[model samples]
Target: MLYLVLAVAIAGEIAATVSLKLSEGFTKLWPSVVVVAGYAIAFTMLSKALKMGMPIGVAYAIWSAVGVAAVAIIGWRFLGENLNPTMIVGLVLVVAGVVTLELGRMH
Candidate 1:
């Protein structure tokens, strides 16, 4: 349940970030509103997940790692950004690091 909440937080954060990019430095009104609202929901859910007993380190690590990867993909797919081989390698490394952090916590 906590993990699900964390996932919602991550999705909200990703949506917020994508909307931010679409906002054109807040010049666009709707995306700007989405940016603010999405972040609000994200932080609220994330805090709930934390209060529900997800460890801070693990939760943050997973959150950041997944967020980065998801945003990168969004940039590539929707924003005309490059999705090159090097970026793929870097995203893989981020996932690996998150896995390592989680595995380390099990000990």
Candidate 2:
């Protein structure tokens, strides 16, 4: 299903992004390889979802926004990055916008 493919793409993208951060500017070998492979899988799944009747704009918006939010949380929790209230608010707004776009497409 398109939804399943999209979910996988999102998960792959999040994993890829996290691995990229752990790659330490790509100086590390294993994490760097993971980053590359994860991105490849993510994009492949995204392409499949597109072929399955999902709108390109909608899918891309959701994918990118969700990826950003997930990465921010990962950074905050695992990377010791600071996330103040403003940052959380901004992420919430991004998620809300994505939800609105998705809902609009159903009409």
| C-alpha lDDT of candidate 1 relative to the true structure | 0.94
Residue range 1-107, candidate 1, lDDT tens digits? 88899999999999999999999999999999999998998999999999999899899889889999999998998899999999999999999999999999889
Clashes of each: 0, 0
Query: Per-residue lDDT of 19-78 in model 2, one digit per residue for the tens?
Result: 998999999999999899899989999999999989998999999999999999999999
Candidate 2: regions farther than 4 A off: none
Query: What clash pairs does model 1 have?
Result: none
Cα lDDT listed for each candidate: 0.94, 0.95
Off by over 4 Å in 1: none
